[model samples]
Target: MTHIVLVIDDDEERARTAAEQVTDLDWDTDALDVTVLHVFTDNVEGATISQFGPAREARDVLEAAGVDVTLAETSGDPADKIVTYAADEDADVICLSGRKRSPAGKAVFGSVSQSVMLNSDRPVLFCPPE
Candidate 1:
C-alpha cells in the first residue's frame, strides 16, 4: 500500500530537513508519496509553490530517495491550512521542521508546528533544526 507523507515548511533548510526525515521513515521508499505543502499567509507577490526554492529542494531530496513527490500551495493561516490539507490528503504522516524556541519565544512568536501538532489528528514527525 502507498504511504502518504505531507511535508510543510516555508524555508529551504527546514524543508530539506523535513524531506530527510521522510526518507528516514521505516516505510519503503518506493511506496512513499510525498506532498510538499507551502502555506502562504500573505502572498502579495503572487508566487507559486513550484517556484518556491524550498519546495523544489524538498522534491529533489525525496526524489533522490526514490519517493514520488508533488509540490502544493495554500493561502491562509499556516496551522489551520496545514491541518486541513493533512486531512484532505489523507496523509499517513505529517512532517514539520521544528525550531528550538524557548517557551517565552513560542508564546510571543507563535509556533506553527506546535499548533499543527495540537490541532491535527494525523501522526506528526517533527524534524528538529539543529
Candidate 2:
C-alpha cells in the first residue's frame, strides 16, 4: 500500500521547507507518497492575512520542489479542520510545524499541535519552527 503523508501547516515558508525535506527524503528512499496539504484557518483573528502569506509561499516552494500538493483554505477552528482532514484522507502520517507557546499561554489558550497529537489516530510528526 502507498503511504500518504499529510502536511498541516499555516506558515508558507515553513510548510514548504518541510515539504521539500520530506520530498528529498522520500526520493532517497522511494518508500512513500508525499502530499502537502496547506490548510489556512480563518477562525483566528488576523490569521487569514498574516498566516495566509506564509501558507501560500510554502505551497509555491513545495510545488517548485516537485512535490505533489493540495492547497485548502478553511474558516473554522484550525485543529478541528486538521483532524477532520487527516481522518478523511486516511493519512498514514501527519506532519505539522509546531510553535512554542509560553507556559501561561499554553495553559490558558492551549496549542493546536497538542490538539492534533491528542486527537489524530494516525502518526504525527511535529517540526519545530526555526
Q: Compute each candidate's TM-score over C-alphas.
A: 0.92, 0.71
TM-score of 2: 0.71
Return the top candidate by TM-score. Answer: 1
For candidate 2, lDDT tens digit of each residue in 1-130? Answer: 3344545565555766666555555452334545555455445564543256655665566566655555555546777887887778778777777777898998899888889899989888777666
> In candidate 1, residue 43 scores what lDDT?
81
Query: Over 4 Å off in model 2, which ranges?
Result: 1-10, 27-51
lDDT of 1 by residue, 21-64 (tens): 77886878776788888888878889898888888988998999
Lowest-sum lDDT 10-residue window in model 2: 26-35
Candidate 1: where are CA atoms >4 Å away?
A: none
Per-model tally of clashing residue pairs:
0, 3
